[model samples]
Target: MKKLTSLLLAFCLTLASFAQQAFEVMTKKPTPGSTIVIEYMPRNTVLQGKKDFEATAYLLEGGLPRAVEVPLKQEGGIFRGSVKTADSTRAVFFAFAKDEIRDNNNDEGYYTALYDKKGEEVPGAHAALASAFGNFGGIWGLKRNQQKGAELNKKEFANTASQKKFATEYASYLSQSKDAADQDALRKLLTERLKNEKISEADLTQTRFFYQNALKDKAMADSVAALLKSRYPAAAQQTELVAQWNKAKTLPEREEVYQKFAAVSSPANELAKNRLEFFDQVIAGMYADSGNYEAAKKYLARIENKQARANALNSIAWKLSGEGINKQPKDAKAGLDFSKQSLALVDEEKKAMKNKPAYLTAKQYQRNLDNTHNMYADTYATLLYHKGDYEQAYAVEKAAVEGFKRKDASMNEAFTALTEKTKGAKAAQAELEKFMEEGKYTPAMKEQLQRLYIANGGTQAQWTSYISNLEEAAYNKFKAELAKQMINVPAPQFALKDLDGKEVSLASLKGKIVVVDFWATWCGPCRASFPGMQTAVNKYKNNPDVAFLFIDTWENDSNRVQKVTDFVAQNKYSFHVLYDDAKSKEGNDFVVVENFKVEGIPTKFVIDRNNNIRFKAVGFDGTADELATELTAMIDMVNAEGGDVKKGF
Candidate 1:
């Protein structure tokens, strides 16, 4: 009776006990250090001495392997060894398995048939090699997030009579066996050949030539021709390429043709109209070269269909805004109009056509709309500056900069979170430090970080750091001068109707100890800390000397007012709930959030009867309980300082 063996799936490692030869990469620590120990079963099968196995490990980067060969020792069906690396970065390891070598001693371990656990014949050395080569190529590409070489895929691997014989013999050996052992061996062999530079150039050229010359199909011919021009232009036969391209008929057939021409020139050149979107790209490129953005807008405006016009206008606007052309004002306004029009067109198309083509076009137009809108923002800021509206200009520029910083921070935080999730805390911290030190942070990084921070309960302190570190000193200087009016100062005074539609004023609460809380219904953490704040509100509500202004700093509208009113009613914890139209006022003017520098939700500020800020706190940081306790103690201290209790309820 055959013994039963259970199979288990382990993410990083697996241990199997079987008659089959098994490879084990043993890590000494619970979490591996830089040095990984490689173990191969049936150690007696390997040759003796430190250098016997002739194994090599690969440190893959950018789809290419940096090989590190390790000396080995055989210890009964298990080969024991270690490969050293510079740092604690986690690595996937592979080692070369070779047959008998031409040793100095001339002693040999004769090649024998390898087998799987089921006792089936493994393919011969050469055959095993070809398959391994293919596997290695695929894995290398995969690690780099790229595709394997197109030339390699199309070309014949073995062409010279000698090499052909070897491949044929190997293929024959592979065919004779059906076991996974044979397949594995073949895969391993091919991987070795891929690393050998000698094999690369020879195999690549032979394969490329075979695919180009032997495969007479127009599509294949054209692809090969284009690939050759791009990859090996000096060796390419332009005449043959031209002939193949001319014969193309179908769309896939035209892929090779387009690539061929694209290799010679840009996609915007004449005779290249593959994608409809490329039309706007071409027009933009042309207009950009001539430095006539107004002319470009004129061209864009001529498009009869709104979608097309939107696309053209969007492209032109993006180019002008990015390049900071002097004539962008006219182009930007037109682009803004076009984007709005395109949005309308997409809505109309969704309702009327509802076809895939129209929908896709609409989507493209919509993307252009967003791109143009982004450009419009920058252009509008510039226009404001030219118009001597320094404050408005600064506001827009600061918003743009903050947007970039937030995006960067969000990306950084994401990478940090992912690393922590996958590799544990130490590795994650190391990755984080690497990012910060290496200047990997970008505008996108800022945006991503801000989004992530918002998601994971961020604070004003984090935002402050984010703003300061947005760019280099010059950029920092420019940003700092602008932020002087916005940062950590007395906020501009503004008033609006409360949830009851009654007039509310900052001046009205002047004489009392005012704790103005700027909040929104959509803010998650804000809602969370409300109960704690309500406790504070209840403690002082009856005291006419104290005023708790629960101001909702969002747009003043019926929907907003209703949401706040409903929240207040459900909770039955009402202070003075008010609304703020942020659209009309800069963030620096909001009493609860902006004036008090409240970064995250549920921010609270304690104002003395003299209307001076006595205490301020940011996030609830699992410290909401602590904050409440502290606030109570502080209130007692304030009362001891002769703070009057005007009215007791």
Candidate 2:
């Protein structure tokens, strides 16, 4: 019994030792500006812990610090890596990352434990939490920490952590602190570091950090800007000028800032005058939005350049002829005056721009001037109808549509058709451009987007590549919103066969909300959406008031029906299937494609009980749960609405 007890005690000690095993780090700045070796030991999760881990050596190369990954090997008990420091290196910082380590108890995701110069963990709020740092205790392990193992004594580690190689603590504080005085002190500390420092690109960026954070503390920002100007005069001036422009309340203050900016950036302040004229154009819009047409016109009159004045007037007139600011009713008569004035200026300016220097007279300026004239003409026609002058309105509106169509055939054919439909100009010039300022994409713009998509084989990457990062996200969001505005149009009726060879019509599916999914047998993304769609289907499956039609369109096979049947059976998908055989082999002239303009496959349409297409989605965004939620929302929307005949997408 005593022998067993002794063995049990030994086992308990071993277990206790294993439980305490955690990461350790030790650093030595061996030979100045030569090499710094870092030794680490991490906790073992399985019978064998991680084989190796990555140590990111934040070493200074030519006074600029950059992170370079150094792979460490485990031998005996510790992980070690010796990396060469760059020339003129002053300090070093180290961190463990992308390690193949896992905890059996928790997988809180990737948490970085930052360490200072002394090899002590510089703990953050996340590190203090038991949920995150439970595994990161200390360097001791089941193996007695030996050579190649970190020789960093606890006393040395504790003392050196206060002074770091990097300005991480200062950077963190500068970003987070709201107190102006505290921020000022930190900036002063950082500035002292910059005095003798030969500035790198990173250092230059950090030096300009004050202006980046200037939106919060304008007074401190001004002080910092003053300091920055002493060092970087041009950059500081430009930054301060923009700040002043954004902050200016009165028009004169804005003009003053604009003049100063223009003087420095453009010789002889030519850009300033043009910018001021543009400013007047924008301010006029603000007045119109406030329902003060007279005030808006007064602002427009401030624009000195004839073309700029006309551009402003054209914008104001468009607002007056249609739904005014915030979709409020417009004043057609008031709009007509501005429209007439703008058209006259447009013609005059066209001749004037030709004589001006090429730089001043850009191609875009000409296009904008011409587009403004076209838009103003619509406003003029709209005003005539409002005053009961239908004959003149019709003649003017028809002429405008024909003029643009002659130049660009793809310039929204719907708008041209709508224009021609006006019985003498009973005022229905509700073109696509009237709503969107820049969103009113012309033929060239639309063709550019289309050709890019076609080149990429109908993938979203092409669309993303065409726009900037910020614009890509915003444009996609805008496009998604546009797709949702279905105009309550009637769902185009179609007769198609099901898997069992029974024919079905949209007419037959009356008194139910029908979900029409245009998919193909081979479309991978379409197939990926099925699981999530199935979850939604299961929810509404028992509800007799809802029906789903999984239309197999744009199928690669000549025998699409057979392929669809095989796929659906193989997956055991409980979906209401329909076959839409393409009239041609290229799959260009299918009924769904031809009638509803389904250019891309995996298009979805939600129809209400009244047979109106209420919602449409063009692609299968990869998220089953999100798709289910959207489907549920669409189903609920139609279900909640009382059965009434509404406007028809």
Best by lDDT: 2
Question: After superposition on all CA atoms, what RMSD does each candidate show versus the true structure?
Answer: 29.3, 25.1
TM-score of 2: 0.30
The local lDDT score (0 to 100) that residue 518 gets in candidate 2 is 85
Candidate 1: stretches off by over 4 Å: 1-492, 555-558, 584-592, 595-597, 623-625, 639-649
Question: What TM-score does candidate 1 get on C-alpha atoms?
Answer: 0.24
Model 1: per-residue lDDT, tens digit, 549-575? 776864344465677788889888776
List model 2 lDDT by residue over 1-649, tens digit each.
Answer: 9567546743542332233344322332133345555555554433245444445554422222344566677677777777665444433334453322323212212112233456433322111211111222221011112110111221112232321333443343344444576567557655665674454433454545643442244454555555656765655566677778778877558657756765565434464456556666776786776777777788688777776787788778777766321123377777778888988988787667653322121443565566666766766766666665666766666666555643322233323333434531222222422312223333333444444345547556645554444334534444454444444787788898888999999999888999998888778888988988898889988899999999987765666677788899999999989878566454534676556656566888888888878877777754565577567766766677523333332
Candidate 2 segments exceeding 4 Å error: 1-241, 244-267, 291-295, 324-328, 352-369, 406-649
Output the worst ten-in-a-row residue range by lDDT, candidate 2: 140-149
- In model 2, the Cα lDDT at residue 410 comes to 29
